[model samples]
Structure formats: structure tokens, C-alpha cells
Target chain A: MTSSTPASAWSRDDTGITVTVSGAWITSRLDQVGWPKAERSDIAGQVVVVDFQKIETLDSNGALVLHRWIEQLRKSAATVELRHPPAFYERITDAYAQSRTGATSPPTGRWGDSLAEIGHRAIDLAKATLHLLSFQGQIAVKLAQTLVRPRQLRAKSVVHHMQAAGVSALPIVGLLSFLLGVVTAYQGADQLARFGAQIFTVNVVGIGVLREMGALITAIVVAGRSASAFAAQIGTMKINEEIDAMRVIGLDPITVLVIPRVLALCLMFPFMVIFADALGILGGAIMATLALDISFGQFLRQFQTGVPILHFWVGLSKAPLFAMAIAAIGCQQGLMVGQDAASVGIRTTAAVVQAIFFVIVIDAGMSIFVSILGV
Target chain B: MPFIEQNFAEPKPEMMPAVRVRGLRTQFGAQVIHDNLDLTINRGEVFGLVGGSGTGKSVLVRTIIGLLRPAAGQIEVFGQNTQANSAAAQALRRQWGIMFQDGALFSSLTVSENIDVPLKEHTRLRAADRRAIIALKLQLAGLDPSAGAKYPAELSGGMRKRAGLARALALDPKIVFLDEPTAGLDPIGAAHFDQLVLDLQAALGLTVVMITHDLDSLYTACNRIGVILKKQLIAGTIAEISARPDPWINDYFNGPRGRAAAFAGAA
Candidate 1:
């Protein structure tokens, strides 16, 4: 036990030879020890024994190193025997031997396996979609019931969630929307100037920013920010058994956790749309004035006269639906989190992806419906 | 030649106590969990830390394992100050293993991979060798070799605790700390776990510090028990503790539940 370094000694006797391995024959010490290399000449027609009794420690690495040497000696016509292996070395050696013979390889049915895997994944996706839809229906019922009895509504929680999901998300939404407007205005100015129609850039920028880019950018940003945050917060509460505790205390998690968040997002999305629309138009105006040599007042007058008020209303109408989709998807994913720490991370990522995808799909449908109605 | 001879002739440093705590104080905002608490765990002893709920048993373990910083006082493991961010403290970490309540296994990693984590971090062993070690550690923890490929979530509560124990013992640590090792287990399972701890301790000469509420485990495995009360630790043998006149300790040990557990332990 005092020796930090592992060592071995060989002794020859009339009956056989004994190799006593001693002093921490662990994986970390294997490199330090000089492994005994047996020769056929010495081992032929004799018995060889490897003793591990004196070893301070013997892990799998040490056992394998010794087992291989013993196997070699036995193959050379020597009667090899292992003596006094540490408590679990026998099991380690048996597993190592079995693995060496490829007994542990996964069974192969390549084409069938691939087909089954794909089918399994498809079914899982369908099941997950159904579950999410059911959760959405439950939330809708809860929303209606609360609307019927407004006193039961958690107003403070709704306001708190608004501050978290909406107020805190303004800067990023504003920045991205402004950048989008600038890029669109710059690109449109190039095409319009080529046709001697530079003033038309204002109409293009105003319509695109007010009717599409402003609302779309804000939804995507909120989906990324608030959806993931809601999922992580709820998933952690589930893991900590706080959700169960809330149930025991006679509180509905949907009422306390889900409703407030969904309502907050729905209320905030329109305000965010308005704010982003202003910033985006301002960005377009600035670009037009500088890039096209148009005066600021001229750009403003053209933007105001060219973009119809109906287009702005059409864009604002999509905000509440987009908000509801994002919030519902996020809360549903959170509630679906399994009782494990890693499930929290997986569900959070899924919440963000699903929320963004749903938001885009809704926006596309809204755009088609508005155009069909001649808005 | 004389200098080399002198260096070679010096005696090795004596092994220090497994754990030592002096004037340890911990607090959370206005709450004081432990104030001026002191403890010493000698080498090669099964030390039990017992206390009422909310007495900071888990917190104390966390503090000693360097997870939580003490508000005041010093902790030393193997003569190295645990609070210092020094190389010696890093080396000292390899000397002890900890098993948390509920196993706390990484849900993503299979049982074998969980055991392999410490081996991979601390050694330069080949993959084959590491695999062999994983298998060995699994068997030592009384688990089937087939359990290696399963995730922590797949294992039952008792099996998860065994897997956690396997991971803890991976590095051949001199000391092992178990937080509530037998909680949430059936009597048979808890007894089996106790026997496993005893067998492993005997085989490895490990100094075990376990926080447990099971009186059966206390009577069966512990050589000494440290009770936490009034923000302080009172250490003694089980018999000594049972003899104390403190109302809580008296009811806890001589109560009907305690008597049944003691009888079971004796059997």
C-alpha cells in the first residue's frame, strides 16, 4: 500500500512460475509497470500462475492487461491460472472476453430497422401534434370560463408576465425591425431609381414595413425569447415537484401559470406591432432621405399618402393570433416535460422551434385571407 | 551523493484525518443553518450524520464537498484546506466520492458511461480498459452487466442509487460520502444497500460518511453518529446517543419505530 508505483516479480519453482502483481495495478498505473512477456520456450509443458493478492487496487484496465498475458501463455501450451483477483475482476474479465468475440454487437436488420425507425418517428410526431392541439383546446376552455367570471382572472400575474415577455423584448424587436426596413428600402431604391421612379421607394417601404415585416419580425423575436423562457421556467417547476405541490394546495397550474402568460402575450403583441411599425417606418424614411437624396418631409408625405390605412390594420390584426399561438405552444411543451433534468432542455428548445413555425404559418394564412378579401 | 542520500532517507508524510471541520458557519439571508459547528471524521470509520429535517445535513455535505461556500470557518479534507483554490485542493477532490439523494445521475448518459466519466477524466486508459473498469464497477455495485447500456431514467429508484454508488467508487476513492443513501427504498432494498456498503467498505478500507434517517442503517452500518441540533453537531456512538436525555433523540431512538428497526438490525 505504501508503494505508489505498481510492480511485479516473477518466481520460478519446481511445479510452476508465479507472477505476483502488486502496488496499485489500476489503469493509471499500468504504464509504469513492466508487463511480463512470456516466451514459448520458458512456458512449454509448465504451469504458470498470475497472483493479484498483493495489488492495492485492480480495475478493469489492470485486469485486461493481466488477462491478455495469461491468455497468451495458455495459447503457448502452458497451463495458465489466475490467482486471487480483486472482488470484481472475474466479472470484468468475462465481459471483456465476451466483448472481444463480438457477442455484444447490436443485432442487424438494416432495411427493416430503418423502415421501423422512420415509421416510429412519424407516429411520434403525429401523437405529439394531437397532444399539443388537445392542450390548446383545454386552454381555450379555461380562457372562456375565466372570461365569463372576470373576478377569477389573475390580473397581477398577467401584468407580471407582460413585463417579462413584452417589455423586456422591445429592444431586440426594434433593432431587427429597423434593420429589416433599412435593407428593404435600400434594395427598393436601387430598382426604382433605375426606372426614374425614386419616389415609389417610399410606397414599397411603407407597405412592406407596415403590413408584413414589422409584425413578422416581432413575432419571430418573441417566439425565440418568451417561448423558450416560459418552457424553461415551467419545466424547472415540474422537475422540482412545485407543480405537484401547487395541485396539493388547491391551485390550478393553468390558471396560475398558463393563462397569465398567454393573456400577457396576446395583450402585448399589438402594442409591440405598433412600436415596431413606427421604428421600421422611421428607418425606411432615414434610408430614403440619405440614399435617394429625397428630403425627410417629402419621404414622410409620400409614405403617408401612398400606404393605405387598411394595410396597417390588416397587419395589426395578425398580432393577437400569433401571440396566442406562440404562448400556447410554449406552455404546452413545458407541461409535456418528463420527470428528468435533460427533458427541461429538450422541451425548451422544442417550444421555441414549434412556436416560431406556428407563428409563420398563421401569418401566411392571414396574408392570404386578407388579400382574398381585397384588404 | 550526500544530498541525494539525505532526500531518499526522509520519512513519508503521515496520512491525515479523512475530514476535519473547525468553527464552520453557514447562513442563507436571515436564516442561520450552522453556527460555529465543528466535526472530525477519522480514517476507516463509518460515520453517520443524523438530524431532523431542515437541520442542514445536506448543506453541510455540500459545503464540505466544495459546492457551497461557508459563510465563516475552515474545512480541511486530508490536511488540505478545501476552501482554497489551489492545486492541492484539486488533488484532494480525487480522494473522495459522493452519492447524492435521488442518485442525481445524468439522465442522458447510460449507467456505464456515467461510471466512465470519472475514469476518462482522471486516467489515460484505453477504451477497452475503460470498458473493463466500467463493467467491474457495475458488478461491484451489485448490478447486472446488462444494466450498463440503460439510461438513468430507465433504472428503478433502487437501481439508480446503485448506479450512483458505482460512479462514486469509480476512482478508488479513500472516502465516500452518501447523502440519504437508503431513502425511498423498501426495507429489503434498504437492507441490501446497507450490506453492499458494508462489503465495499470492508474490501476497500473506505472511510464512509453517510447521512441517513433509517435506524436500521444506523444500527447496522454506522460506528458513530453525529446529530445536528440547535445549529451544532453532537457526535457519539449510537449507544451513547441513545443514552442522551434530549427529548427528540430520546423519542427518536426509543420510540416504537426505533425499537422495531433496532430489533431488525439485531436479527
Candidate 2:
């Protein structure tokens, strides 16, 4: 077998210009060479022939490139023609050309059709936004009522949800935070050593983990794990008509399903933040002692002095808000699920994406507010 | 014209059954769905498989199509064992098509693209020829040409089913398996579908195995009925099977719904 890169050579004479393409004219060798550029003076109003008989192999991509070159030549009034192209290449190029032309020439009256479609989508988005706001208001009112009548709260269900979302999620959150802390400490040690301030690596790891990394990492992890789960579970129940069944029996699905999950997340987020914070600090301390020749006791001492108590409080304070956003987005998407198996999958994915996006936006807002307040 | 020879007929090679199953056993965990079941479906006929819910009617069809493995059984389709997964079995698969319940159309592709998938895989036809075939298939399946551009999610229940049927018939298979073809259609729509199936069967000489609980479909479309009861198949012409003394069979064919369907079919 011959192993050679694809190349094209062109020669011009009184009759015409002939371009011969050879070697593997396929996508894998697309980077090797391109078609040779012909001088306009040599081929002006002259017959041009592209010979593909010497080509070893050609695929769709190569055919498309060649087809475009031929089109360019014809557009320039060069009277171009292809010579001895393989049957498969001819078929593919012809098929692609037909589809391209067919797609480009839109049928009449399609403009009106597209305008109506855009109008429909705009209305749908507006309706969804309004519905989500109204749902949030309804949840606030329900929570207020529960606060007034304390006995209306489902305590057992709340506890169960807390265990599932918090206790069950502890291992993953701890492991991720520890890894984050170790990475930060190692990177900080290397950069600080270059500046002749290696001891200050402890402060970098300490303040960063406490003020931002710990809370952000835990929130993102919980959003991915628990938010999708909540959506899938409720969406499945909606599909089974269990939510409708509850409504028929005079029970509010929001009160029975959404409230417990939201309340549990709100109550558990602070505890998860504290656990994540401890693990993150411990990981930083271990990395510092092993690689930077700093003792564990010295690392802890620097952490205590360099990182203020307010930094820990600020990070902890973001947790409940992040948790509330994640829970609300998840349960709302689930409740809005349509009556099909496919909708469950769609809603679950939407829940995770929306939860993480909202968490990041909320964290940004909090950072700006705290900086303005100088806390 | 040949009465004596017809009475003592000899079986011809071309008249062999399309599908033959013997001693089929299907189970999930400790729950046995079918035990020692046997069935035969002849060529060039519409065979209706009827059973109550949870009776493994869908499982049996899936098993025969090699989607589910049987605990113990011999299932032969087009004279090749479907369980072997050999080249012959793979080739045999191209001879038949299965339309799942709920259409099961690819959610991403447009209707025309979905119908072209099998053609692209199995044939070397030109692009223009494939497009013409797609248009012809849409017309044959009773869909408008405009419907070819719509996604499966954008289609209504009836249109999705028609698009599914178009895809199933893309390869011009000799046999087609339909699961609950008329389950969610309106009466008029279902009747139109039945008539379409009948016309296509006669025109193309297709063998069909359909799972349906709709008694009207049984009376109007099926030439023979196979009832699943007590983990076994009792198959015959409708009249022959209805004459059996089984209590479930009696209730099924003689019940109010069944009788109304039978009367309506007669009318």
C-alpha cells in the first residue's frame, strides 16, 4: 500500500488548464494540502479540467471540498469539468448539491409561517415566566401559613428529605471540597515560593476556601445530585397521575411534595457548609505540611489568624439561599412536566442546568453586596 | 376446479409459515409469564394476538423479534432461528419490521429523515431517488408531504403512528409486526388505518402479526385470532376459537363490548 499525503498540481497550456489531484483525498488528510490556486490570466475564459482518476480515495468531506472548488471555477466563467471521478464520489457530490439547492430556495409564504412560529414562542416564554413568578408567590404564602399554624408542617417528611438530600450527599461533597483545597494549596505554594513568600500560601488557601470555594463547590455538587433527583421523582409521579390523584382527594401537591423538600434543604444547607468547611481546611493543612515543609499546627495557627470569623459566616450565609434556589427550580420544573415519558427526562435535565445557573448568579450578587457593605 | 386434490392437499415450500415457536418459556424473577407456549403464523395473513393486560402479549412479540431472550424456546422467523444472533439472523431481521407501541420514532429526526434511516443503511440508491421514495412512502402512509419536515414531538398521536408505519415499510419487508396499532385512535381514524393495512397487505403481499385488544380490529381486520390464556396460545379462525368452552374466551367474544363490535363489523 502507498502512504502519501494528498496534493493537487495544475498545468496551463493554450487549450486549457488541467488540475490533477492525487493520494488519499479524504478528511484525515485534509490538513496536508489544499487545491492549487490557478492564475486568472492563464485560465481566463479557458476550459479547465479537474481530473479525479488519480485520487486514491475520497469521502464525503473531500467530495464536498472538491465540489465547492468546481463551483467556484464555474462561477468565474472558466468552463470547468470533472474527469473520471469515481462512481461513489459522483453520487455523493450530486446528492449534496441537490440538497443544498433545495434547502436554499424556500417555498413562498414561509415568511408568514416563520413569523407566526416566532410569535408563538415569545408568548410561550412570557407565559412561563409569569407562571414561575406566581408559583414563587404561592410557595411564599404557603410557607407563611405553615409558620402561623406550626402543626400543619409535615415533620416526618421534612426529616426524611433532609436525610436524603443532606446526609446521603455528605461523602461526595466532602471528597470534592478536600480535592479542591489540596489543589489550591499546592498551586499557591508554587507561586508563593517564586515570590519568596512561601509562608503566605497558608493564608491563600485559608481565605479562599472559607469565603468562596467551600460554599460554591458544595452548592454545585448538591445542585447536580439532589436537584435532578427531585425533578425526576416528582415528574414520574406526575406522569403516573399520582399528583392528580392527590388533588382529587383534596390534597395540595405543592404542600405535600415541594414544601418538605425545600424546607429540608434550607435547614440542612448550613450543616453541610460547616462539614465541607472543616474537610477543606484539613485538606489544605495536610498539603501544606507535606509539600511546603510547614507543620500542621503552624498551618492551623496561620489559618486562624489570617482568615477572619466573618469570612466563615459569609460563606455559611450563602448556603441556605443556594439551597432554596436549587430546590425551587427543581420542584417547579418537575410540576410543569407534561403527560409523556419524554418530558420527565427533559424536565430533570432542565432542573440541574437552571439550579446551577441560578446558584452562580446568586453567588455573584452576594459578592457584590458584601463588598459594598465592607463586611 | 380441483376439488379432489384440494381435499388432500400437499404443503408447498412457498406456503411455509412465516413464524413458528415451540415450547417457549418466559419468566422474570419468580413470576412466570409464559410456559411451554407454542404458536404458528402463516404467510400472507393478518394474525391478531389477543390477551388481557400482563399476559405477556408484548413480551412474546418482542421475544420473537429477538429483543428479549426466552428462558427456553425455539423461535424461527423466515426459516432461521432468531435467538442465535448469527449473520443469518441479522439478515433475517431485514425481512421484517416491528412498530412498537407509542410509535417510538426517533425524537431528534424529522419524519422524512426517520423514514430514510433504514434506506440509507440497507440500499445504495441515489439521493434523489431516496427523496422520491420518501415522498411516495409518505403518500402511501396517508401523510401530507408537509409532514415530512416536522419532528416526532411536533406531530399528533395519529400522525406519529403513520410516520412510524412509513418508516417500518421503508425497506419493503415481507412481514410487519404492529403492537397495539389502534389503541389510541378515534373510531373513524382506526377504521381508516385498518383499511389502509388491508389494502397494503393485498397490494404488497405482506404477512402481519398485530397485538390488539380492540375487538373491532379483530373482527374487521384479522383473518385469524390467537388468544393467550393460562400461559398458552389458542389460535384458530375467529369462529373456531370462539366455539371453545374456555370461560375467558367465552366472556371475551360474547361480552357486551365484543358483541357490539361484532354487530358493528357485520353491519
* Candidate 2 stretches greater than 4 Å from native: A1-138, A149-157, A186-203, A231-257, A291-306, A332-354, B1-13, B153-156, B264-267
Tens-digit lDDT track of model 1 for A4-105: 677878899998988888887665567687765666687787887888888877655566677766676788656777787766677567655554443265
DockQ of each: 0.34, 0.05
> Best TM-score goes to which candidate?
1
DockQ for candidate 2: 0.05
Lowest lDDT block of 10, candidate 1 chain A? A97-106
lDDT for each residue of candidate 2 in B104-163, tens digit (9 for 90 to 100): 888767899998998788765557556655765676677877788988878988888889
- Measured by lDDT, the strongest candidate is 1
Kindly provide the TM-score of model 1 when superposed on the true structure, using C-alpha atoms.
0.85
Error of 2 at A111 (Å): 9.2
- Stretches > 4 Å off in candidate 1: A9-16, A39-45, A52-77, A82-111, A129-135, A149-152, A241-256, A287-293, B1-15, B23-36, B71-74, B84-86, B229-231, B245-248, B254-267
Report how far off residue B39 is in candidate 1 (Å).
Answer: 2.6
Candidate 1: tens digits of C-alpha lDDT, residues B215-236: 9999999989999989999999
